[model samples]
Target: MSNELDTLLTALYVDLEDRVLPSLGWSRTHRRGRRPALGDAELLCLAVAQQLLGVASERHWIRYARAHLTGMFPQLPGQSGYGKRLRAAGPLIAAVITELARDVDSWHDVLRLVDSTPLPCAASRETVRRSDLAGHAGYGYCASHSRYFWGFRLYLICTA
Candidate 1:
């Protein structure tokens, strides 16, 4: 891992342990099951760092982490495990981001931007008909790309 990645992981882990986990009741002792080899803080940091690094594919991200980040995340999960963990941690991740954003001193009261994009789910008609996403997915036209997509829309609100 690069020094930057190391620093980010360390700082995030510290903040999570010290500030967030206590309020959220996510301490290791409160968790059940085989007790994940990887802690919640580490998983959250990994997910956020993955997003920050623009890694869109979970499989690719797992492979990259296995090869390059093993030292930082000694117990990195496999693809499926990582997917489940990250999905479970979604709400926590969002909370963490909101908390951190509130501390951004440089951008206070500046222009805030919100944007959204489509999250493609089913492609073919048959797939769309049979998919669990049938109710949530809808036909949407992508004006920027000049194409049609069938999926749920993802709205992102953030400072830009």
Candidate 2:
């Protein structure tokens, strides 16, 4: 990993620790159960860093982080564990994004850019029918790409 990337990761962790968690009222015991090797904040930062660097596949991200980012994330879990942690942290991640956008709005930018993308989910029609997302996700067509998609759409509104 480059020094610049390291700096970004450090900054992200700090922001999450200082700003995000407290605002969300999340404590170390918030999700009481089997303790994870990495805390919610650390795992969130790792996942965000992976996306920021454009690492598409979680498996690939885990492998890369295991090889290169052990110093930053000494407790990084294996692929499956990391995937599960990230999935569980979805709400936390969303909360962080909203908080960050609000912070940016207050500190500097009032203008926000909003966009969305289809999050293709169900693997088959059966899955779509049975999945919890059945009511929320549906078949939709994308005009820009001329493609049919089945899933939920994620809209992101952020500071310009």
Candidate 3:
């Protein structure tokens, strides 16, 4: 049987071996030893992949990661762990993505089309109060209503 998580991990590792591992310092010393840090690609893949599984917030990411993602990407630590790794790799990931979007000799930037509608509080209006305006129930926008209100929206953004 093939495990999706294991397969993905193997592919990711292969990528690192080819692109990243060769460029970094991977030594096992007896001193302080290496920190339990997720690689840049690992963190980014975890973040983006969890988002696909319907996780949005950092806390949610942590929880879901512990429950699902970690099972998929065991390198994913707690929420703090994932956040730290992701944050550390933000710049490097951005540069890698930017470079990947372009060819060796491309003068023009590429483009991608992305659109999403805010599914604000479509729930019972009575259920929403000034104090109830917390989280998704809080300030959200109504795309169908073409107005900015308060509530939760499916937040997902990807750069092309």
Candidate 4:
């Protein structure tokens, strides 16, 4: 890894471990079950690095991490294990994101933009019937497309 990436990861890890995690009252030691080989802070850092590096696939990310990030994360989990852990860490990830976003100078800006897009969960009648989103997702019209879609709406709000 380049020096810039190393610096960014180090700073991110410190901020997460010392500030973000503590503020959220989350401590891995307090939780039950076996202590994970990869700590939450490290996992979160890994995720940030993956996104920054534009590695979309978790399996490929794991492979890359194992090859290049062994120094930072000595005991990285396998692809499946990593996926499970990442899923379980959703709340933690959200919290970290909120904290980091709040720290940004633009967070308090008055100018904001909001938009929504259709997230089609199912298409065919049989697929729609079998889909777990049967009740949660419903038919909605898309003004832009001039068509109806069956799924949930994804809204995004951000500062201008």
- Model 2 root mean square deviation, Cα atoms: 11.1
After TM-score superposition, the amount by which residue 93's alpha carbon in candidate 2 deviates from its true location, in angstroms, is 0.9
If the candidates were sorted by their lDDT against the true structure, best first, what order would they fall in? 4, 1, 2, 3
Residue 46, model 4: Cα distance from true site in angstroms: 0.6
TM-score of each candidate?
Answer: 0.63, 0.65, 0.45, 0.70
By TM-score: ranked, best first:
4, 2, 1, 3
Model 4 ranges off by over 4 Å: 113-160
Q: Would you give me the overall lDDT of model 1?
A: 0.84
Q: Per-residue error at 88 for model 4, in Å?
A: 0.6
Colliding pairs, model 4: none
Candidate 2 backbone clash number: 0
Per TM-score, the best of the predicted structures is 4
Candidate 3 runs further than 4 Å off = 1-13, 20-33, 103-160
Superposed Cα RMSD, model 1: 10.4
TM-score of 4: 0.70
Candidates' RMSD to native: 10.4, 11.1, 11.7, 8.9
Model 4 score (lDDT): 0.92
lDDT of 1 by residue, 81-133 (tens): 99998888888878777777767875576776788787889779999999988
Instruction: Give the worst 10-residue stretch by lDDT in candidate 1.
Output: 23-32
Clashing pairs for model 3 are 136-152, 138-150, 138-151, 139-150, 139-151, 140-149, 140-150, 140-151
Off by over 4 Å in 1: 106-160
Of the two candidates 1 and 3, the one with more favorable TM-score, higher being better, is 1
